[model samples]
Target: MTKISQLDANDGRAELMTDEDVIARIFDHIDNGTTDRGQSSWKEPAVNYQSVDRLDAELALLRHRWIVFCPSSTLEKSGDYIARDAAGIPLIVVRGSDGEVRAFRNACRHRGVQVAKDEGCTSVFVCPYHGWSYGTDGSLRSVPNGDGFPGLEKETRGLVRVDCLEQAGLIFVRQNAGADRSESVPDMPDLIPDSFRVVKSEAMEIEANWKLHLESALEGYHIRSTHQTTFFPVQYDNLTVVEAFGENSRIAFPYQAIERLRGRPKTDWSANGRITYVYHLFPNVIISTFPDCMQVVVIEPLGLERTRQHMFLLTDCAEGGEVLEAVFKGQEFAAKGAIEDRDVVMSAQRGLKSGANDFLEFGLFESAIGRFHTVLKREIEIPAF
Candidate 1:
């Protein structure tokens, strides 16, 4: 196999494999009748996917680590904000008037009600239950009926703060209030950029474990059987370039069109429409590239058997006409393939209840999934302070 180092040692930055490098690996696999593989197959117990205690442990771990919450472009203006639940932690990420990004507990100090709902531009977040207002900076701006409460110092009643960091055009948050407020981040690739604009944003509730949805994006073994009508014709059945950096990994699903570069100059190779790269940003996020748009999917566990997936489709193309139409078409195609994966995962979730097997086996072709589980086990066993 022809593999290239994906990390720059000089600055220790994680970079994607070049288009030419990716093409070479794809060709190498095609000629050798082989795909990326691990040393041995692994079996994961089914109880992890159906245990409430296990779900709680995973949720607690999510609060301690830096997880991608949303794209930075989602909050363009100073007052723009997004309030939602991240792994059961209610958080509001807002751009303060001082032009700095901050995150706080969405709950109001009075009556423990949420101060904001959904997302929008707001100078003040007012609790719908009692009209308690808070500034974008999360200060306790004012409280109604001043005389009803004596010695209610607003300064001491401000919203509790959470750790927040924004880099590479994405926003990340640590829900742990006592978490170290350092600048350390994971080995993340530059997926989002300022030029990319969010064209669609939506949330989905999946009746399966959050990991199930993430496992769907880590391999091309199911492309032919699962995405026959949607992705098989354009992509290879089991050909992929799998590379890992730290705890993160990128699974490249090259399009059949890449064959055109067989004899072309390396300078002429561009990845734009010739391949799809699914970047697993560790833990719970997958940033994938399509021919027309880039999709960021964040998976959140709702319960033992439920999960919430937040999807953002972004594009750098101009608005309207054939170009815009192609973007929509690409989005539709990706959505269809997602539905196919959803159905299969849901079936697997159902199988967990049948007790047909104590453990679910993963083959060598599913090496990325195996790596994910390995990292997850190590993280879960480590103490979170």
Candidate 2:
């Protein structure tokens, strides 16, 4: 609860770091933060725990391989800012003064208290827990009572940085998942083209285990039946997988054309039915954006039965570019349809948690969702550690 000033009793000489230092700090966070800490929380990871199908669980667990933990995925769109500390839970993402990304544990190395709370950014992140202050570059530039803790490496003791990558307009963070780290990124970039970019994103929470919500996202088999009012009339062509990994599957669909839906408001046109390209990243993230057509990324876990979807609106047509209202409506309808999905995903989670359901079967066309589970089993239960 204390501010950095309180600890920086000799705060007179703390100078600001250079922009190049910030960039170097960005890479440093990625390479060095991998060192395992003894205590981190994982009570509700994205994997499904109750199911006997180790495959299902491992498929969800695979995404954890790339998580850099804490100081990764700096949210720049919100302006240069970072998530405070890990608090024993992974999720700090900060932007250095130079505008490069850096993620931290949100925890102060000294007292282990979170430096950033909720979401906020600062040029120099000073831990409120004590006077330990770090520049945007992750250097322990200032610390009060320099005489204490003899031999303490001020420069080396700054908060740890997690490994991260920004590709295809998306950020990837590396993680070990309680074991040794995974070497490659499963060739995710190859599956998607350079033409695609994350236009925008929002996180939505749903009720259910992370895996359960992911299962629902993996397949669109329940599209017609689950989203009756929103997409009942649209042709539910089933889901297709473009890539499958040890614990992840990438699926894409051809949503119906924008012009096809004739008589409807933009918001309700989702009922017109259209083809869509949806990508289900392994483990926790889903990049289900329809390039220039639609953009969305949904997270299936926040808490138990809680998931968040990062929604974005994309377009090839420039601002003021000529496009029919019907076309716009198609995208609108598509978003409406996804809202319907949240309800079904949440409901499915409730059913699974109930003892009444042993194991819900995936229809033939909805097989990718099952394959997603198969991948989960491979990654999570292994004892490679």
lDDT of each: 0.83, 0.49
lDDT of 2 by residue, 120-166 (tens): 65667677866788776677888788788889888778887766555
Lowest summed lDDT over 10 consecutive residues: which window, candidate 1? 1-10
* Best lDDT among the predictions, by candidate number: 1
Cα displacement (Å) at residue 127, model 1: 1.0
Residue 211, model 2: lDDT of 64
Q: Per-candidate TM vs. native?
A: 0.94, 0.66
How big is the positional error of residue 211 in model 2, measured in Å on the Cα after superposition? 1.5
Per-residue alpha-carbon lDDT of model 1 for 107-213, expressed as tens digits? 99998999988999989998888888999988998888977879998998999888888888899998873445657565766777667877789999999888887
